[model samples]
Target: MFVLHIALQGCLRGGEVVFGLTADTGGHIRYLLDLVAASSQDVGVDRIVVATRLFHGAPGPDYAVPEERISDKVELVRLASASPAYRSKEAMHAEVESFARNLVAWIAAQPRPPDLIHAHYADAASVAGLVADRLGIPFVFTAHSLGRVKAAMLGPAAAGCPDLARRIAAEEAALARASLVIASSRDEAEVQYAGYAAYEPGRIRVLPPGSDLARFAAAEPRPQVDAAIDRFLHDPGKPTLLALARPVARKNLGALVRAYGESPELQARANLVLMAGTREDIDALDGDMAGTMREILVLIDCYDLYGRVAYPKTHRPEDVPAIYAHARARGGLFVNPALNEPFGLTLLEASAAGLPLVATDSGGPNDIVETCGNGLLVDPRAPEAIAAACLRILDEPGLYAACVAGGARAAAAYDWDRHAARYHTLLRALLAPEPPLATPRQLLVCDIDNTLVGCAAALGIFRRWRSRQAGLAFGVATGRSFHSAMAILEQQESPRPQVMITSVGSEIHHLDANGVTYTADAAWRARVSADWDRDGVRAALADLDGLVPQGSLEQRGHKLSYFGDAATAQAVRARLVRAGRRANVIHSHGRYLDVLPVAASKGTAVDHVRARYGLPERAVFVAGDSGNDVEMLRAQGHAIIVANYSDDLASQAGLTHSYVARASHARGIIEGVGHFRRMLADAG
Candidate 1:
């Protein structure tokens, strides 16, 4: 079987193809190259193509090659975009449309199109989605980091990425259309894809990327790596806390610096080593890395941490193992304090080297810590948390030994050979022609806030139920904007929804592996936009006693939000009605008041979604707790209200076919499902 792997950014060169030759070319490049090398050894795979974008100048003339053979079975295919000069991935979004066209033309001219296309990162996913669609081949996506997730973490102050909306929309579109999504961790599969409406939990497969075990094994110690660290450290014998990553905002390097600076115990015990980039001059650096470097320097000077912190701007790729070996030799640990990690490849590298770890309790670390059992997970945002985790490993000899052993054991499963074997099996299965399974006709539409999450036991039980029950579908309806809802859903690790009723039902989205496709209600948008004077409304409500504007994320195209008590909400609603505004005002959780287009409501959205999917009344179950969910709960014949529901929801006691559950949160959902199933069983 022929497989096409697409990675569209970074400087591409042949010969050595060293993974960490520079900070800009990180784990993803290593992941692609290693996978190709391993797959070349797999007998089932006939040929491998590593398709990438071409850049002009800088790295070397080697990048100008149209195609270069890496081995008898593997080759690199470089496709150029519209512009000549190289730019960061964020700047390359606009050129992707042309890139896709060029790639498709190139493929069409080939002897035969690839059997399957696997795109890595957002840009590659975008381009690959279009190419795969045009050629009628299955498309797979591996989003190393999600744009929506990043935007949520950084907010409006985010730098470098100006076109967040375009990126997010592209991701959603790619997700919706892709045949399969390769997630490096379970957190990525379940949490990151939560907001998209067409997300099928079944389509995602959790396949962790592998490390080069041969390079990082515990037995191989490099003197050069030790020498490199010795040159930077005030005392080479001190227990070190090493952090290796690009100086990006999301990596949270500044926070790690602060954590080290704040803790006297940490400083007294271990030195902090950051291998950030290849530039020694801070001012010479540019873009996100420069900003990170500037902040790190300020913290260093402010904390008087000179001689205590070592940040080397350059390192050879072969030096990475020696770097890990140096830390291990010093009885030190590796720390990854990224705001959110998609997957921690370096954690595996460090673990394989018998180095103990202290990483953030975010994304990949959760799985890595669990599988490795060699580290402590803490909140990367908190300096105290980061410091505490590092201190534990540094101070306790018994704990340190256990972590080393655990890491070696865990590292075995993550070798490139095992990773390639798994992929070989998965691909062979996917390539085999089989009868299509029946789609789930019955759907459970539920609200996210205070209903689906916050009850761990029930959520676990629900996840088990979803796994066993193949014919049932699930979706989420919330007042949250798409991004906000996704942030919440990601933490729950629940099933991916087939539909999302976001922004108080002002927006509808159909999700697929290709990306999210918006189901536009143009007439609804026009009706709301026609006479809606947002500035006037803000001015009119500015002086209200208890009301405040909702956060930027809460404000949507046809929705204006405020946080206020019931009295203020009533006053705002009455005032808006008296002013003859075409709005539907909803008060939920006694604090959130949303003013939306009169044409939109959770109930209306449910009807629209139900009609589109052609689901029957008996097959749909709607669940909620707050007032915003009341319309949807009442709209469906099969409805549920949890025991902890607000008084506003309880007041709807007269609604037909509505069941009040004895359990709260996800437990309530389980009880509600049981109630509906019994009714259906009786009727049948």
Candidate 2:
């Protein structure tokens, strides 16, 4: 499949990227390049075009080139925007309309339009969104760093910046328009994006970007790179505290300097090395980058930290790995005190180079440090916390050794090939003419816990049998939440389902074309929401005897769960009826009680799915084993009651026509399905 990547605010090109060359030219460029390179290796990916804005200015002549081939299947295509000069991310909004038009025109000229468009950052997403709308294509958004997150991190300082508001607006638009949002960490997906007006957790996926760290892992300290840093240090042999990032206030480099300067113990334990971008002249740098540099310098001088600190003016792109190696060789810690890091790519690189980290507790480092077990997380705003964390790692040899071993795991944990394969699968699903749910001739909805997964040997046989039925769409109608159901299915290595009716039919989620992510059914939610007063039902049944509220996980927006007996369930229904509130009260196993919307039940939900797919009653099959399954079993003509059924489900009213299988669990489901298919065959 052809994929187009749009990244409008960077000096994007192939080979030896000079990061820190432009304020906008940083980690996002590295991420995009690595992602595209990895994507090119996928057999399913036919062609990849990296689209960016063409400009001529200070960075270099390379940015002016309209097109440059990176590999056989990948090429960089730069489109001319309104302005020719380099534009920072803030300035990107002015050029969006022009870039979008040019991008669309460019695509129109291609041999075949790309199967999908992937937007990098907010500005690029805005441009891609417009291009997609015009071309009738779907685009996925990756907000490398969110404007709201940055604004929040900057706090009072962010208020002075007018462009930040516009950037946030563009991000909201991107979130609303994009088909999918790919996040690098749980922090990005859950916490950061949750603040947005267009936030939808269902559409946002956390797919960590893989880094090419082999070079860093095997890197040896070069004399040139070491000398650049060592010359500024009084004792070069001391463990180095390295902070490598663009010299921006958001990176919190000034805080790191203060942290190092305030503590004499930390100062003696490790030499501070600040590789804050390549600057020929500090004064020549623009805006925040220049101010940040001046602040670091002032802090260094204020605390009389001249001999102990190494703030290098410049280094080549190839020298990055060696810089990490230099720190690793000296038993140093890689520090990222960024106010908010979207994803800590440098943290991964440092770990791969055998340098343990002292990262900020704000963002992506939470996931990285947890996964790698290679570092300590400190509050970036607290200089004392930063100093203390550094001292702890430096003072303890055992902890240092543990971190080093953990650092070794980074290379395998974040791999590009694995990322590319998963990415390709998602794209392939997006390009599918129809989702698996849309065109299936028949659907088989089964209960998860008892009916589908109880017998491992029976499940294996069922899996093989299900795979052979080309026109059959399989799904689960579970009392469990979406996440809970998915967890069990994945653990059992069960066949991927096309539909999941979770939370006892209050929530419906359908599998996406990508086969990995699921989209919630809004129509079903709206249907169940009508006349359903959740708060009223709860208040009515609050003091009902023998009823106790279940834990938070069991409670859903449309479903209220309780640990109660059948008598309590009956009382709950009576209370709701007397209060004039409509709800469906379900009691199973003589113990668990679930209160759902009057329109929602396992049976009603099964009918909704059948009707949605335009399947006849004869074409829809449902199998269940207990009390909650009664509605579902009676709702369909092709119902299966497993031999290991509970709650007297087989003897339930209106279930007389339901098939009673001799076998149990998955074996029972298989037997009942065959019986129904034969009955249909005989009727025909």
lDDT of 2: 0.88
Candidate 2 vs. true structure, TM-score: 0.75
For candidate 1, which ten residues in a row score worst on lDDT?
Answer: 513-522
TM-score of 1: 0.64
The per-model lDDT (C-alpha) reads 0.77, 0.88
**Residue 554 C-alpha lDDT in model 2:** 67
Tell me how far the alpha carbon of residue 437 in candidate 1 is from the true structure, in angstroms, after superposition: 6.7
Candidate No. with top TM-score: 2
Per-residue lDDT for 333-400 in model 1, tens only? 99999998989988988988888888977687877787778899888889999999899887788999
The CA lDDT at 30 in model 1 is: 72
> Could you give candidate 2's per-residue lDDT for residues 1-684 as a string of tens digits?
899999987788898888887788899989999999999888878999999989897778998999999999999998898999988888889999999999989989989998899999989888888887798889999999999988887789899988999999999999999888888876777678878999876677666788988998999999999999999988999999999999987899999999988999998888999999989888788657988899998898899999899988899888999999999899999999999898899999999999889999877898788888999998899999999999999988999889989989999878888777767755776677345655889999999988999999999999999889989999999998765676467546688789999888888988876666678888999999999888988888888889999855468789999999877777888888799998888899889899999999989998998888998888999999999888898889999999999998888889999999999999999999999999999999
Question: Which regions in candidate 1 have their CA more than 4 angstroms from the true location?
Answer: 15-24, 158-161, 219-221, 436-684
Candidate 1 CA-lDDT value? 0.77
Q: Count backbone overlaps in model 1.
A: 25
